[model samples]
Target: MPITTEKEQLVAELSDKLTRTKGAVLTTYSGLSVAQDTKLRRKLREAEVEYRVVKNTLTRIAAAKANITGLDKHLEGTTAIAISYTDPVAPAKVLSEFVKELKGKNLEIKAGIVEGKVIDANGVKSLASLPSREVLLAQLLAGMQSPIVGLVNVLHGTTRNLVCALEAIRKQKESA
Candidate 1:
């Protein structure tokens, strides 16, 4: 059936948002009950991600205009999109965890877009496996500081040893 005027407007708005998003994940959701669907939507909302089941044709048009090509191929089956505007990895992590919990839900990640680049299924999985922004920043800080800390400790040890040797020599000289 042709989409209604309101639906067209809604799709247009969603497409605009998708165009401006930093990352988006496309997934094929089959064998999910209505209750499961509601749960998924709730989780997505909690993560501040937008999830929608758009018509494949409209999706293709929006994707092409936004320079996201090759997404049409994965548009087959019962497709839904999760768009993330602020945090690129949020949608991926959420969807990956949801799929894991569902187990036999038959939810397959099709593809994704990150920083205007199209990525396949494996790419999405890898993206999902990435740590959050705060965690990554903390790890980076630790990595950057470790060498400096080691250098400081080494310098302190050398200085302490030299001081101890000087003290011993002074004591021996005084005794002699």
Candidate 2:
């Protein structure tokens, strides 16, 4: 069966969005008030996340077109999407925080995609809990440098001990 013209257009647009999006978080927003939705949108905007309320059918079509499988089960009940084209974790983190703030209201994380992998709700939460990009990069650098630093310190201490031992021997000989 052919979809209506408007529905087809919506599906096409959503497919485009999914295709171009670097990362995407699918959520359910059922019981949010207008004010709360506005607040959530603002927060997402601040984080450079693109927020969209999508129809489930259209979303499913888009997901299929994008070759993202097993997401149809998650496309139920007032589906919304937060897409992050630049920062993979931005939408996940912001949406997770917003849901937490609402005390787990009608907003529920369904699933997400990162680097072409389908992640479930728990996976999305874990991604949200991860440190920011800069923090992660810093930690990685520190971890990479620790062993080198330890090796350098060990070499220095050994060299210093050898020098001290030679000096002590020289002093004893001189005294003798």
Give me the candidate number with maximum TM-score: 2
Query: What is the Cα-based TM-score of model 2?
Result: 0.87
Candidates' TM-scores?
0.84, 0.87
How many residue pairs clash in all the candidates, one count each? 0, 0
Q: Kindly list the per-residue Cα lDDT of model 1 for residues 145-175, writing each as its tens digit.
A: 9999999999999999999999999999999
Residue 37 local lDDT, model 1: 87
Clashing pairs in 1: none
Model 2, runs deviating above 4 Å: 1-9
lDDT winner:
2
Worst 10 residues of 2 by lDDT: 14-23
> Please, what are the lDDT tens digits per residue for candidate 2 over residues 51-165?
9888888788878988778888887778889998888899889999998998898789999988667899999999999999999999999999999999999999999999999
